[model samples]
Target: MTHEEKRAWIRLIVAVIAYTAYVVVILRRAEGGPLPDVPYAAALLWTIGGAIAAAILAEIGMAIVNPRASRVIDVRDKEIGRFGDYTGQAFVAIGAVAAMLMAVAEWDRFWIANVIYLFFVLSAILGDVTKIILYRRSVPTW
Candidate 1:
């Protein structure tokens, strides 16, 4: 696999792990209380911070292990990157719309924050997945 492809895989894995960690922590604290009462802001912040750190560490480790293998960035890579970015941006819009609807409905801040966070994670996952698939298969001409 190419270096970029490996990076995509790393992102996918990190996104999943980070999201799962956030959910697990929230659920553990949730107990039997109402959903809005669950402590989520700290968990959300931690997961975001941790995910960023993990991603950077993973990239550094990958670079250190095989310095020569990770240097290439070519035409195909750029194209795939753009495609993946465009694909992922859709989710951000969706998330914004969801948050707007929640606000209109007078939903709790917890729900609104969680929904936004979830959409960001989904965007990362979807973008990474798109890049991975594009790397594996030929990008179709449109």
Candidate 2:
């Protein structure tokens, strides 16, 4: 696999795993109480930080495991990246709108924060998936 593809895989895996861990932690804490009442800020922050650390570490490990792996970035790579970013940004916009609406409706901070976090994770996963797919197949030209 190419270096970029490996990076994409790392991102996808890390995002999913981090989000899942956060959900599990939050749910466990909510077993006997309201979800909003659960202590989620620490868990959310930790998971986000952990995901970033894990992805960086994984990339470093990959480089160590295959020192000869090509790290070249071609025009196709750039195009595929742009495509993935554009594809993923939709979720971010949606999340922002949702959060704004929630805030206007006077929803709990927990719900608004979680929605934003969820969309961020989804954006990463979708972007990574798109990059991987384009790498495996072809990137459409405009």
Candidate 3:
């Protein structure tokens, strides 16, 4: 796989793992009782931070493991990136719209914030998945 492909795999794996961990923690915290208010801000922040740190660490580890892998960014890479970005951007817009509606509806801040965070994570995962798929297949012509 290319360096970019590896990065996509790393992002997809890391995002899923980190998000799963966050969800598990929240679920565990709510066990044996009513779904208590989730401490969403700190949890979301930490999960985002941890996902970033983990991705960086994974990339570093991959570099060390394959010291001779060419980390080159070529035309195909750029094309795949652009395609993925465009594919994933819709989720961000949806998230923003959802948050705005929630605000107008006077939903709790926690719900609004978590919805935004969920959409962002969805965006990243979907983007990376798109990149991976494009890498596997030929880029479609317009």
Candidate 4:
């Protein structure tokens, strides 16, 4: 694969891993148990550490694979990114509408939150997949 393609795959893998970790953490928190009190300072430190680690790993991975090109995101990439953002927003809107309707109908369920989260994830995945498909099918520019 080209360096750019390899970098993209690496990024996708990292994103999947990070998101899976986040989901697992949330699930663990949801399980009924005596939760330890998290101090704000400790929580802030943890958040910062996680963010820094993730950012460093991502940057290093991309730099190692595609040092020059990794620093630049072209117009096509920006367009695809915008498309993804739009898809995410659409998912959020759909989830909000569903929640509102359910509330109006007096349906209360804890699983609704999970459904909304899944909707967002699925929407993002679909958007990325669609963008890749389009990129592959389109004619190349000179």
Candidate 5:
């Protein structure tokens, strides 16, 4: 696999891990388990802080392991990123509209939020997969 492909995989893995952690947290909260008796505000703050820290550390580690591989993305890379972003955004917009309609039709529920989140995650995965397929099929610009 190319360096870019490796990087994409790393990002995907990181996203999956983060989302899995989020799911676990939500499940725990729903189960009414004691979570150190921290205030909701404090928990939210800590989760955000931890996510940021984890992202920073992952980036640093990826760069350290692939210094030359990670530096300066080329034009094709930028194009792929743009395409993926646009695709993901389109999915999010569609998901939001569907969620709104569902809320009106069926009443708001936790499952609606979970469905939206799942849509977002699936969009991201599909976008990355599409980019990789394109890259593999097309000739390299460089």
Candidate 6:
């Protein structure tokens, strides 16, 4: 696989693992209690930070293991990246709008924050999946 494809795989794996871990922790904390009152901010922040760190470390490991892999970017990489970014950004916009509406409605901060975080994680997964798919299928020319 290409370097970019490997990076996408790494990100996808890390995101899934981290998000799952966060959800599990939150659910356990919510046993017989309201989810909104489960003290999720720390878990959310820690999971996000851990995911970022894990992805970076995994990429570095990949580079170390395959020292000869080309790091050079070409036109295809740019096109695929643009396509994936656009696909991912749709969820971000949706998340922002949802959060804004929640705020305007005076919704619970917990709900609003969780919604935003969920959307962001979905965006990453979708974007990484798109990039991996494009890499496997070959990018189409416009």
lDDT tens digits, residue span 25-54, model 2: 999989978898998899999999999999
Q: If both were scored by lDDT, which would come out higher, candidate 1 or candidate 6? A: 6
lDDT per residue, candidate 3, 38-85, as tens digits? 566677789989999999999999999999999889999999999998
lDDT of 6 by residue, 13-103 (tens): 9989999999999999999799988999999999999999999999999999999999998998888888988898889999999999999
lDDT of 6 at 2: 78
Q: Which number leads on TM-score?
A: 2
Q: Per-residue error at 89 for model 5, in Å?
A: 2.8
lDDT of 5 by residue, 4-79 (tens): 6665665566557666776677667657854433234444445546655776687778778777774567887787
Better of 1 and 5 by lDDT: 1
Q: Would you give me the overall lDDT of model 3?
A: 0.90
- Across residues 1-142, which tens digit of lDDT does each residue of candidate 1 receive? 8988888998999999999999888888989778789878888998999999999899899999998885679999999999998999999999999999999999999999999999999999999999999999988689
lDDT of 4 by residue, 4-52 (tens): 3344444445445555665556556647653332122333334436645
- Candidate ranking (TM-score, best to worst): 2, 6, 1, 3, 5, 4
Each prediction's whole-model lDDT (CA) = 0.92, 0.94, 0.90, 0.55, 0.66, 0.93
* Candidate 2 wrongly placed segments (more than 4 Å): none
TM-score preference between candidates 2 and 3, better one: 2
Worst 10 residues of 2 by lDDT: 133-142
**Model 1: lDDT of residue 90:** 94
- Give the runs in model 5 whose Cα sits over 4 Å from its true position: 1-4, 24-53, 139-142
Candidate 2: count of backbone clashes, pairs at least 3 residues apart or interchain:
0
Q: Which residue segments of model 3 deviate by more than 4 Å?
A: 32-36
List the lowest-lDDT window of 10 residues for candidate 3. 32-41
What TM-score do all the candidates reach, one by one? Answer: 0.96, 0.98, 0.95, 0.53, 0.65, 0.97
Q: What TM-score does model 5 achieve against the real structure? A: 0.65
Query: Order the candidates by lDDT, highest first — what do you get?
Result: 2, 6, 1, 3, 5, 4
Task: Choose 2 or 5, whichever is better by TM-score.
Answer: 2
In model 6, the Cα lDDT at residue 31 comes to 96
Give stretches of model 4 more than 4 Å off. Answer: 1-56, 139-142
